[model samples]
Target: MQSGKFKTFYLPLAAIAAIIAGLALSFAWAAGLLGHRTTTRTFLGDSLQHFEPGYRRAHGKGICFTGVFRSSGAAASLSKARFFSQQEFPVIGRFSIGAGDPHAADTSTTTVSMALLLTADDKSQWRMKLNNAPYFPTRNAEGFLAQRSAFEPDPATGQPDPVRVAAFFKEYPEARKAVEYKATASSPSSFAGAQYNVINAFVLLAADGKRQPVRWSMRPRTTLGSLSAGDRAKASRDFLFDDIKQRLAIAPLYWDLTLQLAEAGDPIDDPSQPWPEERKQVIAGTLAVTGVHDQAAGGCRDINFDPTLVPPGIELSNDPVLAARAGIYAHSYNARLREIGLGKATEAVGHGDSH
Candidate 1:
């Protein structure tokens, strides 16, 4: 009788435990914890027809730079970050075009970018990935993925189908603003003349526990110049990189770090929208590009420049895109490091094979 009772109780309990384990495995698969996670590979596959192993999946064409950031003491009231103090911090930065292929021609794309990593004396680091665009094309990662899919090249024509592109803009009307901006905007004559904006907003925590929302831009001190038709015709495949290197050889390039303070009713989470021009602005500091080096030399080449990696006085805002970028960048960094370890690294354009 005791054996019969034990069998009845324990059998039911064993079946219940088995059902729970099965449900957990199912949930893990659905949540992407065990399979099919969206990553940098997903977006890159949608954007590019080919993959360049051992290199960044996006903005692969770049030049590394080292510099110094001299804080002006003007931004001390905004945040307690050491870089805001009146001192100099070492900086590693990269300048690149918005292309998936590292060997893409300089004139192939008008979009340019700057990624910066500033190291304070305390060893804390502030990293930023900025672009010349006034605002991002999509508000969130899903929207961006859809946008890339919509513009993906058709195998037969080697260009995006207008019907698909139109459908995408119809569904996501906000993206039209960025497309319009790109249509009317002129490409910078040189990288030194381009202004790079941190599209996402971040919070500055002061010593008094006060918080402020702000977006910043590196406003090049070099006067903006237009690219002449003759100059464009004569441009080499690496004109922009060559031009920056030649310019740096003569003197250091400089940009004033300008911050735009957000007021009431401003959108802190959406990077697709821009703040009003009349908002309060502050000159935080100056960034001086003291030297330029080949990517193969290993300066800023391996750095991910994840924007979410902020120092102690700074905090990430509720921007969904910012949060998504952290994961995507981490995956790209790790994947490329593995490739390098396996000796699968390839040479970047104009730079010899990475070692």
Candidate 2:
């Protein structure tokens, strides 16, 4: 009788203990999966493994430009930020090839990117980081790191491993948005002709205390000259960089900063998930890029357009990827500074758990 009672009680207790132990082990294993680490250094190391550390940054790896953002009453109702409500704001912009290869050919660089730092008289600033793609590839830091890992240097050849990248794509369906966008995108004749998009959603705090979720795109005012494969193929190595310089010399380049309001049921947390094409859009202001300069010795050289440098009147949405980018940008900036013997100044601080 005692044996039977002990068996009934002890068996249940043993089963419970086993279940608890299994859960604990699983949690620990899950936490450490995919070379995930909590520190900025470790995460960035993984993120940039495919590229060598250089004075240039990971994304905007080429020319830098200085400009001015001419704001009007258009954005005054949306946010109380001085830069947006004021007449003019000094802008530091960078134009670059897709990757850290500063000398990467225009045709080889699948997408071009732009980064801007808009500063107001009050010194309160807002930064916008945009890419030519209509959508983002990976939505979060983990996925971002994982995708980069897929392109990590091959042991035998020291080049990108196609098979690994293919495997990663097979596992991640969301990454298709980036691939499709890049594949169909027509090469712009000049940086001024490129349409830069802000895929992540942000909350704009109105002067009247109303909050609205919005996504924005900076559309080039210039009629873009489409480049044929033959045209890009036959062009000089630095054609994209030189083309921008020539274009800027003629007249100020213009990009209308257009904001799209997100309706209810829209995906505010996932940058990979773009809102419906029919969403309401408002033209916030014009970004007049006045000049082009070398990235190494330009105003934008030291400026880290921390995507989350959200001004007082603006708040970032719950998009995990968007939230995590500020730290990554800081890390990249520190790396650039360190590479040029400028030395690392400070550590990055931002929201979201590091993966």
Candidate 3:
């Protein structure tokens, strides 16, 4: 009887262990650990799988940043880029925060944030991630990331400390200019009321094949636009989204997509500094949001548009961030792809199949 009982219990326990081991192996395989097949599995698993979930829970789609696609706004005239010659092209813009988790509300409370996306023709897309200040103190990504890491919340306590903020700039003196600029600024009624810009200069290719490296800015149209201290006091975490929704409901949000041309052989790598107005050209284009997209699908989905995805005629003019971002973003995107079930193996196959 004892021998029989042992056989029954041991057989079941062994079988269960075998199943668990197989699952672990499969998971690693899916995560790209074992071989090429595993790598492909990892890619699919990482890339688009979380898009739906993120959209549902976070109320955002994973596009350029944290903001959702909300709605694919109407494609109208070339009004935003007022100075450019008349030629129309279908384009899309995704507004989002520059954060790790795509679902984070784009509150002005953060140290760094942005509205990043690609142009329809892929001629002038950018990661327009900036802080509340007008200028960036660091000349490159390394310095910026270092400072951001230090200023961000402490992993242990999940609280951002004044000491960390102070130490970040103290260690990186280049940040002083930007920090000072932010400090002296008048406190706004709402952080969401502040305008965001692409601090780095980029190239905006015109219909005639001319490339103009430009800085893009989006500002509130009305004088009643200021977000006051009282307003900020009552501001919701998703103030930007709500404010945008309200604005789009009443009137289209107009943004003049201006181009700042770079001089022949001018430095384009370090985008921290701006070209003088006299030397730069302001080629304007219209960006009107007829409607806001679904917050979740627009912001938290698995879509990440990298700056390097520029089309022909619109080339990288030796921008450091552009080059750095290309590699970093490619690796990041690939990693995320691997995390999902649709791994890299299938992506290449699909790309080839399309051709």
Top TM-score model: 1
Worst 10-residue lDDT window for candidate 2 reads 346-355
Give all candidates' CA lDDT scores. Answer: 0.85, 0.76, 0.48
Which model scores highest in lDDT?
1
- What are the TM-scores, per candidate, against the unseen true structure? 0.87, 0.79, 0.57
**Residue 224 deviation, candidate 1, in Å?**
3.0
**After superposition, which runs of candidate 1 have C-alpha atoms over 4 Å from their true positions?**
1-36, 39-41, 48-50, 153-159, 347-355
Residue-level lDDT of model 1, residues 1-355, one tens digit each, is 9999999999899999999999999986544345335644575455444467777878888888999999999989889999899499899999999877888888778889999999998999999999999898888877888887888899999999999999998887899998888777766689999999999999999989999999999999999686776877778888899889899999999999999999989999999999999999999999999888888674787788999999999999999889878767776777777787787877552246421
The reply for model 2, stretches above 4 Å from the true place, is 1-43, 50-54, 150-171, 342-355
Give candidate 2's error at residue 299 in angstroms: 1.6
Name the better of 1 and 3 by lDDT: 1
Clashing pairs in 1: none
Q: For model 2, what is the alpha-carbon lDDT of residue 181?
A: 77
Please list all clashing residue pairs in model 2, or write none if there are none.
none
Q: What is the lDDT of candidate 1?
A: 0.85
RMSD of each: 4.2, 9.5, 14.2
